[model samples]
Each structure stands twice: as C-alpha cells, then as structure tokens.
Target: MSTSFRMPSIVAALGLAGATLLCTAHAQIKVAMVMPTTGPLTQYGDMVKEGVTTAVEMANAAGGVGGKKIELVAIDDACEPKQGPVAANRVVNAKIGYVIGPVCSGASIAAAPIYNNEGVVVITPSATSPALTDGKNYQFIFRTIGRDDQQGPAAAKFIAEKAKPKKVAVLHDKQSYGQGIASSVRDDLKKAGINVALFEGINAGDSDYSAVITKLKGAGVDFVYYGGYHPEMGLLLRQAGEQGLKVRMMGPEGVGNPEVNAIAGPAVEGMLVTLPADFSANPRNAAVVAAFKDKKRNASGAFQLTSFAATQALLAGLKAVGDNPAKVAEYLHKSTIDTVLGPVSWNKQGDLNSFDFQVFQWHKDGGKSPAAK
Candidate 1:
C-alpha cells in the first residue's frame, strides 16, 4: 500500500529504497497521492497511478512545475472511508505540500478536513459527490471530476432522450458516491417524467444480487441504473444476464474502467457510463497525449492528464511562494495553469472552475465511446 515517487531512471542516483522510489525535486514540494493500491479497488488505484506517474514524468522532463522536477509519494487507503484520515496523517507527517487523490468519494471526504486543517492543497481526479464541495469550508479540497448533480442530469438526458426508456429501476451501493449520484439521477428522471419504477440499495461486497435481479425482473423495468463501483456493477450485469434479464444498464464513471469488462464477461456489452469528456480527443491535448505515449503510458482513460493538471496547479502556486504548503494553498485559490485535461482554474470552495460531464457507453468486446450506443 506504499508507493515511492522516484522512477527507476532516477533510482540509483537518488538511492531509492528497493523498487519504490522517493526523490527530491527543485521546488522541495513533495506531493502525495492517496489512493487504494490494494484490496478490491486495486484496479482503480492502478488507474490513478498510471495518470499521476505519467504526469510527473512529463512535468519533470519539461523542467518540472516551475524549474523544479516534481516528485510523487503515494499511499494506499484501500478506497475505504475510514482509511482516509490515516492516509492524510501520513501525507501531513511526510510534510508533503500538496496531494492529488483519495480516488473514492468516501475516502476523499474522510481526508479533506484533515488536509484543509493542515493547509494542504488537495485535488481529486475522480471523487465526485456533491457533498464533497458542500458549503465549501475546506478551501483546499478540489475535484476535476464532475459532481453527481451534474452527472445525474447527463444520465437522465441520455435515458429520457436517447434511449427513450419507458420504465427504469435505479440502484446504488449506498455509499456517499453511490447514493449522491443515484439521488441526482432519481431527481432528474422524476423531473423528466420518466417512470422510476423502483429505487433500492444493495449491499456492496456481497456476491449475490439475485434477489435484486428478481425485483428488477418483476418491476418490468426496461433499463437499470446503478450508482457504484465496477465490481458490484459487473456482478449485477453478469448475474442479470444469467437470469435472462434483457434490460439496459447504466452508471456513472465509477463503472467505466476496462476491468469491468473482464469481470462481467460478455454481459457488460452496451453498458452506459457518464464521465468527464475525453481530454485526449481534444486537438489541443495532442502534445500531452504524445508525451504520455512516448513514456509507454496510455493517455486515454487514465485520468492522469487531470492528475497532471492538478500537479501543475500545485507547482505553479508554489513558485509564487516558495515551498510553504499553507501559503501555496492560499495562492492556489486563484491561479490558472494549462494541463492535459484543459485550461484549469479553481474556486475557493475547491471546485473546478468548470463543471462538465459526458455520457459514455461501454461495449463488452467492442468500443467504449463518449456517445451512447
């Protein structure tokens, strides 16, 4: 669950411990990545790793954030909400100036207050619950990912306009991320006058969803929307297929990972997901994409570009005021930097200057596109 910031190329020079690298950079501002590199959400943690590492390499090669190479220190929180504060404590004790994650919503929530109190700037690439930015007390918490309020409307637009689903059932894992998104979707669907036949919460980490599937079948729902992670969604999709349920399934970015296909088998065919727009597809990002590919990493789907953007924001702010974490955070309140994701700006509440979400469809063996099937 521990990761080092030093890459192999710099390992021998920096004398990194074993395979894990921890090196110093010009700004003397070490940024930690708090994510789940173990447990059930390992795939998600890996995705975050790919993004952060690629961005760090690119920034370092480009003369670092501000004439200083960037260093990434990572710690695994297992995506558990309770582990969040523990991870934050490590980051604070390590004296890192900034942080880029707590990939899951619950974890992010748990860690935000601690980081804010410590005056550490934190930006999450994936956490997207409306509550994360509610009232905006923690000026340090920021998210490039769209909120559930935004994602819910997008999902509703797809269902009501594109799919024309007559009857639908909404399900969630009942976590902060899941329930918030589900509520948004529910509200949007209700506003659109779509019949949300059933609304239920299924226990996460349980392999059995047959009972829920039974309810779905009897509900005569034409579409099912699940607000949760890939594993639970995969199980539901696979079990639904086994039970001969012919309904369409949709979810938010939480289930968009490619690994979902492997877990669900062919049953994941045509699943719908809502996520931030494809940053790599933007012509302006061609250079960043090329840089990432040169380093043997996929710029697409890995939210690393956003992570890169977060790192850049942190570094740019730091240059304005040495390597002071508190001062850097205060400076981050008003700074714009160009990154792989897009031109970035942060509000005081730690929300992105922009709120954008896109609906994507996952094809079991074909393609996952921003557009619905």
Candidate 2:
C-alpha cells in the first residue's frame, strides 16, 4: 500500500511539471521584426536584428516582461514598398502585437496603414522619411529615429558652415526617401544663402554615373550631396573619381554602409554622412554595449542602438500594461521611457519628441569619426 501511494504521488508531480512547462511556452510575448532578410539592404536588417535580438535576450535573462519570455519573429519585406503590406499581413495573421521595424522609409510608409488599422504597434528604427508620419495620424506607429527633415537640416548646416563650399550640387535617386531629403537639403542650403548649382535625379542601379559626373564638373560644384543608399553613392563616387570630378560628397545615413567602401574603394574616404548620435559611447549604456560586444556585434552602427531602444520601449510598455498593443501605444504616446538612446518620448504623430542627428566623416576602413569642423 505504501509503494502504490508513492507511485500515484510521483505521477501527479510529473503531470504538474509538464503543465507548467506548457504554460510557460504559451505565455511568450511575440514581437515580430519586419525587415529585409533577402535583398541588397539585408545589412541594414542585420544591424537592426542584432539590436532587437540582444534586447530580447537580455530581457529574458532578467525574467522577461510580466513573467513572459519575449519571442521575436522575423517577417521579411525586402525593403520593397510592394512587399510591405504582405509582410504586415503575415505578422497580423500570426497575431504578433508588436513590431520592431520596416527598415526603409518606403516600406514603412507602405506598411503603416495595415499595422495601424490592425492595432499592431510598430516602431521603426531606421525609416527617416517625413511622409511616413506627416499626415497619417497613425497612433499605432512610432519611430525611435528622427525624420529626414531633421537629418537634412543637420547635413545642410554642416555643409553651409563647416565645409562651406562655393557651389553645392544636390542629386537624388528620385525615390521618396532620397528625393525628399535632397529637396530638404537644397531648400535649407538656399535659405542659408549657399549656391545650389545643380539639382538632378539619377537612375538608381546604373553602372555608369559619368554623365552626372560630367554635369557636376560642368556646373563647377565644389560639393555634392546625394540623397540615397550606398550603392548609387558608391558608384557615383567611384565614377566621379575616375572621371576627375573631384568634389567632396555627403549623404544621409542611408549611404553610411560598409559595402560602399568596397564599391568606391579609397574614394569612400572623407565622405560625410548624417547619422544618429553614437549611443554606444554613453556611460549609462556601458552594460548594453558590453552585451553587444559579448555577441560580437557592434552597437555603434546606424540603427543598432535605435532598434535596441525601440525594443526597450515596447517591452517597457508590455511590462506596464501586459501584451495589449493598443494600451502600449497609448502608453508610449504619453510616457517618457529611458532607453539606450536616453529618455525617449513620442509626439502625437508617432515621431520621437526629439532626436540627435550628427555629422560623421567616413573612412575607407569602414569606421566613422565625428566630422572634423
């Protein structure tokens, strides 16, 4: 009788343990990362992923949010506008209540409506297009980074004051993000009474930018600003160098990729870019920076810390109000959360209340230093 009673008690204990394991599995809070997994812009996605993955892992090690482990699901949009809604639908279908990014501005703008309408809270770390939140009134969407307008002015200020070129030429890829920022820089430069010699659009994937380089040479511009990604910027720089149209070039953070170094070779050196302030240098972020170093990731990349901060804001809200997306969105709109980027709060339109866009001088070895004044 004693043996039989002990057997039943042991079985009951095993059953209870199994039930707890299942409960923990079901209690995980799923946050989807909407970004490019396959594309030329995959590096950008990888940078953001490093940040989100680190934040999630650190949070899980600390007992997770509201006693639930956070699960990150990657949904690829390929940084293409047409694929944005498709990626958003996949996240919605999987019932993920929070998202870390749709990395590029065009993709974010395309995906914003779906995320907002479905009550999913999306915080993009790298999309800087002003049109993403300009008139959308999107409560469920937010940004940890500044808009292109903000970055544009910072670049223009440095160009007008520090670089102080005699004739500036503005070029863009004619895409939404590139053109928008190029226009902003051009207008600001004009207002600052700098000569904007030429404003033109170039084909994005062209191999030869000699024609445009010829234009720059003919226009006698001393400085050029190209508002686009690194590929075109790299090509333009290489072709310009080859064609002997030697003008200093500058761009927004989109062109701040290491791949540009390979494309442009030594021509990439001295390239000026506007990027988010380096948060990895902050004393308050020492632990977080160490966490990144432990995983062999660089926390100083353009979107890494911003993405980490986006994850932090989301998790903080989840801790405060559980896994409800709408409540988290409301909380984010009203509350200031301390993140790796420091204290961050959002405006009614889901843009950050304030952000720092700094100038950096790119080196051929894929490192950046604060721009020399």
Candidate 3:
C-alpha cells in the first residue's frame, strides 16, 4: 500500500522471478527468527524459539514447505528498539523470504518498515504495540498477537466488575509496549467511572522501586495495574510487600514469567495478569504440545502458541502459493488459518481477524502456579 515504490519495478521483478521458476526451488526454505535470545527478554524469546522449532519439525516430517525442509536462522535483538533495525537487516541480508518475531513491541515497530520494504513476510507473536502496525498497511507485516486495545478493555471490565476496587493506580515502564497498554487501561478505567488514583510511568531495568511503592502506599491505592515485563514488576511486588502495602497488583501478559515469581518471592501470591487463553489447554493442540515437550522444550507460555500459529499460517501460505512472499502475505490476509490458538485470520492491516484475551491469578504462596480463577 506504500506509494514510495515504483509499481513497474515490482511488476518486472515478479514477472522475471516467476518466469524463471514456477515452483519453489529444491533448496531448503530459510526462515529468519528475530528475537532477544539474550538479555532481558531471553525468557520470552526462548519460548518463541521452542514453538517455531516444534512446528518446523512437524512440517519437515510432513515433507516440508513445497517439498523443501525448513531452516531457521535465529538472531538476537536484545529487545532494544535501537537494535531492531540491525536485527531486521541481518534477516534481510540472509535473504529469508519469511520471518517470525522481534519479541518486543518497540523492536518490532522499528524493524517493520525494513521488512515491508524488502517484501518479506513477517508475523510477530508477541509484539502488541498499536503503533507497530498503525498506518503501515505493510502488505508484508502481520501479527498473531492481539493489541493492547483489545486486552486493556477486557482487563478494565474485569477490574471494574470483579475486583471492584475503590481506586486504581496504573504504572508502566514508559517503553512503547508498556505505555501503550497502560494508557489503554487508564482510559478504559476512566470510561467505567473508576477513579484512577495515579497514572505514572516508571523506569525499566531498575532493581529497586521502593519510592514507587511508597507513593502507592501513601495514595491508599486499592489495586495497581502495571504494564511491563516480569523483571520490574517482580521488583515492585517485593518492594511493595516490604513496605507492608496491601493492594492487589495486576499486569498484562508481559508479567507472566516464572522468573517473576522467583524474584518477587511469595509477594506475587494472588496477583492478577491477563494473557491470551491457554492454548495448551485446548485439545486441538495436544499433538503440538506433545511434540514440544518430547524435545524437552517447554511450549507452555503466553506467546509460544501464537508463534506456532503464525508459523502455521506462514507454511499454509507457502503450500498455497509455493513460497512467493507477496502471495503468501495475500493468502494469509484472506485465509482462516486453523492453529493451536484456534482459527486465526487477518485484517487488511495484518492484525488478527478477531480479539481474544484471558485473565489468571498468580499464587506464589500456593506453589507459584496460575489458577486462571
């Protein structure tokens, strides 16, 4: 949809490329996976890797994409927005036709234009920033994950009706993903006529948040809604407990790591967080989950199943059109992909065809398990 490119060049290139080979080459299908395999988001990246690897194995066992095996090129982006351009460039330089992930929202937004311009198909599993796809209409970019706009309203509805706290406080890491969802939640809460006692942004990667806890306690906040990954939330939980604050805490899917419980200790008990419904719990995904656990990789996390679904859509498009990136993107845009996360389709903007979200409660005191209650 970008007017920047000459239509003649695209038509010429497609004609030349199509005329040379009507079908996929016998060479292996190389797909690039961009994520933070190291650094703060290492945990989330590991889950995505597991899901993509599992699905790749399944496809290969079935004779692969257009009779060619899949070869994944995993690259680390460290979840930094500044590193997104470089990570995207590495994938493009490798000449991958299809790509999955760039786990963080800021990183995904940064890398999207480059992928779109290069005519590569990218479907992110965990990048939930509204700005990432806003006005891009990038024919090549898509996401299996729903946006904060979908999740924030679900969370606000739950908090307003279920928790019914007298007052709420919203906090975020001030990064793109965190701030986007936090702002959505704030607006929804206001719409529900719930008084948001405080709406503030906090520093990310900080070890101590006693000052923030002190302010929350002084404000007499009944519940705190946070938007960030596990690390900072863990620190806040521990600090809030240390300061004898009794307010309940809630966050988005970014706060669902087991490491959060480890860091927060028992303080995370009874905390609430929203995620896409548990895909592993679906009987339709039994085979997929078994395949992953058989390989000693945990496929039990928020985005991994969505990642699997994205790869499934990618492969489906490949089978439908023989690995043509533009056609694959077109097919994905129009087709309803049956996946571990249920039937997934896409809009013209490359976002999900529908919105889905869920809520869970962390019971660290009860052996650090989520009850989904």
Candidate 4:
C-alpha cells in the first residue's frame, strides 16, 4: 500500500515538472536581431550580434527580466533595402516585440514602417540617416546613433578648421544614407565659407573609380569626401593612389570598417572617418568590457557598444512596463536608460537627444585613433 501511494505521488511530481518546463518556455521574452549575416557588411553585423548576445546573456544571468529569460532570434537582411521588409515581417510573424538592428541605414529605413505598423520596437545601433526619423513620428523606431545632419556638421567643422582645404570634392553612392550625408556635408561646408569644387555620385558595386579620380584631379580637389561604404571607398582610395592623385580622403561611419585596409592597402592609413566617440573606455563599462573580452569578442568596434546599449534600452523598457511593445515604446520615450553607452534618452522623434560624433584616423594595421587636429 505504501508503494502504491508513493507511485501516485511520483506521477504527480512528474506532471508538475512537465508543466514547469512548459511555463518556462512560454515565459521567455523574444527579441529579434535584423542585420546582415551574409554579404559585404557581415563583419559589422557580427559585431552587433556579439554585443546584443552578450548584453542579453548578462541580463539572463542576473535572473532575467521579471524572472523570465530573453531569447534572441537572428534574421539576416543582407544590408539590402529589398530584404529589410522581408526580415521585418519574419520578426512580426514570430511575434517578437523588440528588434536590435537592421544595422545599415538603407535596411533600417526600409524596415522601419513594418515594425511601426506591427507595434514591434526597433532600435537600430548604427543606422544614422536623418531620413529614418526626420518627419515620421515612428512610435516603435529609435536609434542609438546620431543623424547624418549632426555628423555632417561635425565633419564639416573639422575639415574647415583643420584640413583647411582650398578645394573640396564630395562623392556619394546615391543611396539614401550616402546621398543624404553627402548633401548635408556639402551644405555645411558651403555654410562654413568653404568651396566644394565637385559633387557627384558613383555606382556602388563598380570595381573602378579611375574616371572619378581623374575628375577630382582635374577639379584640383585637395580634400575628397566620399559618402559611401568601405567597398567603394577602398577602391577609390587604392585607385586614386594608383592614379597619382595625392589627396586626403574622408568618409562617414559607413566607411569605418577594418576591411577597408585590406582593400586599400597602405592607402587606408591616414584616412579620416567620422564615428561615435568610443564608449568602451568608460570606467562604468569595465565589467561589460571584461565580459566581451572573456568571450573573445571585440567591444571596441563601431557598433558593439551601441548595439549593447540598444539591447539595454529594450530591456529597460520591458522591465518598466512589461513585454507589450506599445508600453515599452512609451516607457522608452519617457525614461532615461543607463546603458553601456552611458545614460541615454530619446527625443519625441525617436532619435537620441544627443550623441557625440568624432573623427578618427584609420591605420593600415587595422587600428584607429582620434584624428590629429
């Protein structure tokens, strides 16, 4: 009779264990990462993924949000505008309430509307085009990076004050991000009483920029600012050097990849590019930095800390108002989140209230430092 009684209790205990496991699975909060996992910008995507994953793991280790674990769902948009909406829909279909990327500006712009309509909160770590949030009151969209308009003025001021070039030329890839920033820098340079000798657009995938280099040389441009990705920028640098066009080249954050050195060879050295000031050196982020180092991940890349901060912002919103995307969006709009990037607050337009954009000089050794004034 004792054995019979024990058997029934054992069965009940097993049933309870099964139910607990089911509850644990159901209680997990899902967050999606939409970025390029394939294609030219894969390294940038890897940096963002590492940062987001590390931040989520750290959060989970600390008992998670409200005792529920956070689950990551990664979707590759290939950094292409055409693929962005497709990835956004995939996240929506999976019922994910938050997203940490769509790292490239073109992808983010394409995906923003889908996330907004579905009430899924999207916080892009690196997409900085002013068009993303300029006039759209996207309740579900936010960015950790500064807009191109803001970055443009910073670059323009630096050029005017430091480079002091008598003739400058502007080039772009004709995409939203590339063209918008080039235009902003052009306007700002003009406003600064600097002469912009040439402004043109180049096809992104073309292997040669010899024709463009000839134009720049003919224009007598001492300073060349190309608003595009590393691929074209690298080709331009290498080709310009081969053509004996001695000029200083600069670009926006899109061109701030270490891979540029491989493509441009020695020409990448001394190339100035604008990016967010490094935040990994902050003493407050020591623990986070150590965690990344322990995992063999770089916490100092262009998007790593910003992506971590984006995850933190999402988690903060979740903690404040539960997992509802709308509530989280409202919470984010009203609250200042203390994250790896330090305290951050968003304006009504879903852009950060302020972000420090600075210029860095790239080295052929795959390292970068603050540009000398």
lDDT of 4 at 114: 94
Off by over 4 Å in 1: 1-21, 24-27, 65-67
The per-residue C-alpha lDDT of model 3 at residue 94 equals 66
Error of 3 at 215 (Å): 0.7
Candidate number that wins on lDDT, 1 or 4: 4
**What order do you get sorting by lDDT, best first?**
2, 4, 3, 1
lDDT by residue (1-373, candidate 2, tens digit) is 1111110011111121111111124347878788888878888999998898888778776778977877677778888999888888887877779999999999999999999999999999999999999988899999999999899999999999999999999999998899999999999999999999899999888888888898899999999999999999999888899989889999999999899999999999999999999999999898888888877889999999999999999999999988899999999999999999999999999999899999999999999999975
Quote the positional error of residue 176 for candidate 4 in Å. 0.6
Each model's C-alpha lDDT?
Answer: 0.79, 0.88, 0.82, 0.86
Query: Which structure is stronger by lDDT: 2 or 4?
Result: 2
TM-score attained by model 4 = 0.92
The stretch of ten residues in a row with the least summed lDDT in candidate 1 is 11-20
Q: Which lDDT tens digits does candidate 4 get at residues 292-368?
A: 87777888888999999999999998888897999999999998999877799999989999899999999999999
Instruction: Give residue 198's lDDT in candidate 4 (0 to 100).
Output: 97
Backbone steric clashes in candidate 1, count:
2
What does candidate 3 score in Cα RMSD to the true structure?
A: 8.7
Q: What are the RMSDs of all candidates, in order?
A: 4.0, 8.4, 8.7, 8.4
TM-score of each model, paired residue for residue: 0.92, 0.93, 0.91, 0.92
Error of 1 at 244 (Å): 0.7
* Residue 296 accuracy (lDDT) in model 3: 74
lDDT of 3: 0.82
TM-score of 1: 0.92
Model 1: clashing residue pairs? Answer: 6-21, 51-304
What does candidate 3 score on TM? 0.91
